[model samples]
Structures are given as C-alpha cells and as structure tokens.
Target: MTGSPTHEPWEVYALKYTRNDKPRRMDVMLGEGGSTDPMPMDYFIWVLCRGSRTVLVDLGFHAQVAARRNRVLLRTPLEALATMDLHPANIDDIVITHLHFDHAGGIDQFPDTPIHLQASEMAFATGACMAMPAIGGFYEEDDVKELVRKLFRGQLTLHEGDDVLEPGLSVHWIGGHTGGTQVIRVWTRRGWLVLASDASHYFVNVLQRRPFMWTYNVGDHLLGFERLLALADSTDHLIPGHDPLVMEQYPPPCADLQGIVARLDADPLFSVHDRIPVQAGR
Candidate 1:
C-alpha cells in the first residue's frame, strides 16, 4: 500500500464513518422522478497511502453533528483510520471535495495539516449563496469558520482549478452538488480511479445520467458525470460518494474489515450496474 515516485499506484481505502438507514429512493434519485424503494446511504472518507505519504479525502462529520443531523455515526473518521494504522499525525494533507458538513467537519481534528480545497468552493460557502438557508443548510457554520481559521493560520491550500497534490494524486473542480465541488483522481493498481465525492452520490447517478437531489448547478453536475467517466480508467473505476453498494461491490482489505472499509485498488466482487458476481480482473 506504499508508493514511491516510480511506483505511483497508490492503495486507496474507503472508510465508512456514518450511515443513514432509510433514505428514500426518491430522495437519492431526484431527477429520475421518485421511487419508494429503500436506499440507505453511507458516508465515507478516503485514504490514499504511498511511501511515507498519506492523503485523506473529505473529513467525516463530527459525532455531535451526526447526532444533530440524525445520522448514525458508526465511528469517528480518526477511529476508522486507526483500524488501518493511520493517525492524524500520519496524514500528510487532506483534499476536501467540498465544504459540506459531512465532508469538512473533521478539519479541526488535524489543525496543523495543510488542507487542500477548491477556491470556488471556499467562495461559494462564504458568499451570498450561503445567505439562503436552503443552500447554506448543507454547510455547517463551525466547519466554515474552522476553514476560515485555517486560511488565516496559513494551513489551507486553495486551488483555482485542477491541481495535483503529488505525482499520482490530484483534484479536479466540477461544481454540481455545491458551488465548488470537486472529485479526486488517483492512479491506482487498477489504473486511474475517480473518487466521485458528491459529484455522483451513487453509481446510478452517473451511470443512469440522473443528478443527485441536492445540487448547486444541475448543468455542471450533469457534465461532471462525463468528466468522471473520462477521468477513470473505466466505468467500474469510478466510486460514488455515498452509495452503500460500494461496501457490497468491493471486498474489504481483509476479512475482519468487511463492510467497514473497502479496498478501492482491487477489482470489485460484483458489477455495479448488474450486481452480479464477476470474475477476477473483469
């Protein structure tokens, strides 16, 4: 799971930190009309490990925030990382896909680490758009204020567009769910994988061309689907942000971690589209 300059294929882990037991199908697939089927949601924070380097994507929300929002807080993001032997001190940097509470709430846990974010996202979270409760409700004031503090403390790295964190890891701005939402692209053993954090909340969102329920700009969100496909090595390489199916599709790093964390660098056990078992390396 470690990488060097030449060995750029990093090991990516999707750590599930929170869960929503009963998200209506209609709520998740808003553009495709609505359905009464039950579709649960899982919140995640990703970990990318290389030689002496570890990058985290999207810090999970705090326990209190989860309780306030009525989400099932499985565990803290730090606790999830500890299962993989990663700690706040070991995180080199963090890539915040957006400033939503679920994604940016844990910034305070790593006060000294440099957090990378999209410039537009920062502006959007702090701009006039936030004055509207509907738009601002997704973002937590504490998280935004913490980010502002990070800016003043010189621990934030704001990127205007697509930016590289290193040789194999990068972030691309693709606004849809929020003003400056972005996705993470990483070179993995399976090839390029797009961590579609909120860009596509579920595989069906992109695979079926349906936008998620919450969005800042529908056009950008729709375009982001194509962008994600292009960024990934293949359709299966694109991982959705909140789909519980991710746990079912991809195998865990080990037997003990089943349903808790998924090893993204490995081939999935089932096809995301059909949910059928697939041969290895398919």
Candidate 2:
C-alpha cells in the first residue's frame, strides 16, 4: 500500500472486498444459470500513488447503502485509505467508473478531492434510465445527491471523452457495463495496466466472451475487452472488476496487508492455482 516519495510512476493496489451474504450464479450472468447455483464474487477499489499524489478508482458504498442491499460492508472507503496511511480528504483524485451505487456510494468521504467521471455516465444516471425501476435500483439517490453536492462546489471534473489525468494515469471510456463506465490505465513497474471496473466482472467474461447479464450495451461490453487488452501490459495485466482470483494472482503488497491490499503493479505469480474453475461445455 506504500507509494514512492521519489515520485516514481504510480503503483496500483486493488483494495480487497467481498459480500457478507449468500452467492448466486443467476445474479452473475444473463439468462444462463439457475438461481440455486453458487457464484462467488470479490469487490475491489483501486488505489494509485505517484509521488505525493494518491488516487482512488472507486469509492464503494457505505454502511447505509450496504444495509439496503444486505451486503457486508467490510470496510469504508476512508478505512481503506487509512490502511495506506492516507486520509480521505488528502486523496488527490477520485475516478468513478460509473454512477452505480456500489461504486459511487462513498462520495461523502472525500468531498474536496477532484472526482473524475465520464460525462455520459452522469447524464445517464439522471436521464431517461431513471424511469426504469429495474435500471434505477442500481443507483442509490443519496450517493447521487452527494455527487451533485460536490459538483456545485466545483470539485467534480466530468470528462467528455478519454482524457489523461497525468503522465502515467489515464481513463478510457468503455461503455459496456454502463454508458459512462470507464476503466483506468496506469503505467507501473511491470508496464501498463488496465483496471476493468465492471467492464469485465470476471476474467472469464473477457476470456470466454461472456457479458455480464446487466450490461447496457452488449456491443460495447464485448469491445471493452479488446480496449482493455490494448491498454494492458499483458493478459494478466488487466484486472477484472470482481474476481476473487485477483487476490490469488496478485499477492498483497506486504504480509500485513494480506487479503486487504493487492499490489497490482507488481509482477503476478503466474500459477494455475489462481485460476477459477470454468464450467465444462460452454
């Protein structure tokens, strides 16, 4: 979780998380599985550091939102930063991949940090999609209100399209999971890495061309894989949004941070032991 005082290119870590409730394969895919099957998932919010700048990719939901969904809130966004000796108010930037409640719910934590997001995402979150109860349920109004509050304070930076935040960190608009769902690309010690935020919830989603059931645009969802691949140093360089295998593939930054922090920029241990089992006969 430590960054360089020497101002080296950013090192990225995927702060670990998981639900406190039961799992369901039906929830993971679209029209493919029975609700009775088990589908384990992991959640992550990336932390990036370069010199004095520390960036958070997503601010996961808080206790209130967690309570509504019956999800286990293992740690708040502020707590995640505290692990790295960082205070929420000191975060240099916050890049929200989309406006989904799970990812954007913790906006109340870092009010002053510049929040980056694709304009399309914001538009859609408040647009016609709001009329659809099914689609609207993904967003918690309190989270959106917090963002609007920040926007009025001039703390929000909405990206019209792909843009660079700096030399080594950039965001690409990948409209699959959501219209404004963008992923982060960072230059690290290993090379370039792409953090696919719900762009590819599971590695199998990209490796096997399976899109998450709740995607907005099917084409964009599928193309996101190629775009992510293009930015990644290698196949392993691209991190899936909610795959437990991420922990196994990339070890924690330190022994003390085991299961709490994963150093993504570091070389991953290429072992089959990290791979999740793919069901037979697709």
Candidate 3:
C-alpha cells in the first residue's frame, strides 16, 4: 500500500528528546533579553507518515551528547522514543535539517534508516568550516564523521535544490542558520505544515523578524524565514525547530507505548495572530 491516500488524513508524531535549559535560555534571549520567563526547552523527533514508509524530521539529541558536552541529559532521545514505543530501527527515513550536533546526533542510532540532507550541508561539513575553530563550535566532528560514513554506505541521500519527496511532501533549500539548512513542508489536516527546523529555532525569530545569532548569512537567514512563512498556511502551522511553546500548543500523542508522541491527525487550535507577517526586509 502507498500508505494513506491523498484524501486520507496524514499523521505526524513529535517524539520528545532532550527538554531542558539551554533552549530555555535561548528563548529568553529572543523574547525578553534574558529576563525571567516560564519558557522551557522542548526538543522532538517529528515523525511523519505511516505504513510502508515512515519519515522523521530531525532526530532529537542522543543521551551521550550531554555528557560529551559536559552537561546533563535532562531528556534523553532514546527514553523519549520509548515513551511512544518507537525503536531506532522503526524509522525508515530521516530528513536532517542541518548537521548541528543536537539535531543530527541521534542518527547513528538508526543504523538502517535512509537520511536526507541538502547537498550544501555536506560541502559545509567537509569544507574549510570544519577546520576553522570558530565555525567548528557549532558542529561535532565525531558526529559528522559518522554521518559521512553513512553517506558512503548509501544510507544518506543528498538533495541539491527544491524537490518533492512524495506528493504533498517537499524539501526546500533555505540555508541561513547554516550553509545547508532546509525546511520540510507537508500537507496536513490543518493545512500546510512547515517544519522550520533550525531555519528559525524560536517562534520569536519569526515574530520579531530577527535572525538568530548563529547564522552564517544573516541575509539568507532572514530570507529563509520569509520563504518558510510563505509556504506555511499560517504562522501556527510553521513549527519552529526548538520552541517550548510547541509542546503546549499541539495535541498530545495517541495512547500506546509512545503516547507522548504527538498525533498529527488531530487539528491544532490555531490563532489568527499566528499568521506570518509580511517579510520585513523583503
């Protein structure tokens, strides 16, 4: 079977990974300039589709990632997957938004899964940037080395430009945060669902029309947000890569071994203000 027919509802699940402090601080810096707020970090494994093919957008942080960075594992990716009864091997396909350690670290855990990434990202990781200490801070050489091995093994698929993976499922090159960042757009029950993975890490990045600090090209970063907003039916439909508000907004996952995994079939309570404003610099 081709999984759900075009007319049938599509399902996407948000598998929790590490939900902790660093992201919370990032949100504070974006929203209140370091002022205290109740925001918390919520990371996830955006699982889409079902049946013969299962797609995951950005695997959450691995357990060892924290310890490697000399931090605590507030939320381990494997534990989060267990909540939904999903094993690493269950994932058929993965769309890696960028090669940042947090988003791409857990990939090796799924040995057989085919991974998709922009061609430019591959260049960035292999080029002089990896050797430059400044830019290297954003990436983990060990993790990327493993990804490179996967590519050689044909487990990684590199996309050059805008391309459709399936009907209603497409990948758009929107580099900014990194040299090869991209966003995934899917036709959902609530309309177009654009997964803004790292293109804009926080909702405030969109709300204030401000580019995050880690961008390689602020201009492209700003433009990427506009492009993503245009692709989304509304701002609420454009999910940020690391916003804590996302946890409260989307419906909880179905009951099972992985109940916390979000059920994409459920409609979100969208807000009119969630609509993306006109691109400020455009």
Query: What are the clashing pairs of model 1?
Result: 3-51
* Total clashing pairs for each candidate: 1, 0, 2
Model 3: which ten-residue window has the lowest total lDDT? Answer: 23-32
Candidate 2 lDDT (Cα, 0 to 1): 0.80
TM-score of each: 0.93, 0.90, 0.85
Candidate 2, superposed: residue stretches over 4 Å from native:
1-7, 30-37, 271-282
Q: Give the alpha carbon lDDT tens digit for every residue of 1-282 in model 3.
A: 113336543577676665656433443332246545555566676878745566778876666667877656646777776666667777778899988888888766888888899999989988898877768787877778878889899888899978888877889999988899989888767677788888877777876677767778877887887898888876777788777666656668654533356664466645525543443544
The lowest-lDDT stretch of 10 consecutive residues in candidate 1 is 273-282
Clashing pairs in 3: 83-258, 84-258
lDDT of 1 by residue, 162-217 (tens): 98888988889999899899899898888888999999897778887788878889
Candidate 3 TM-score, C-alpha based: 0.85
Using lDDT as the measure, what is the rank order of every candidate, best first?
A: 1, 2, 3
Cα lDDT of model 2 by residue, 1-282, tens digit: 122223256789998655533566565675465676556777778899888778888988887777778888678766777787878866888999998887897787776788999999998988888778788889888878888888899999899878988877888999989878999888887777889989988787876667888898988887887777777766777898888778878888789888888899888977422564433223
Local distance difference test, each candidate: 0.87, 0.80, 0.74
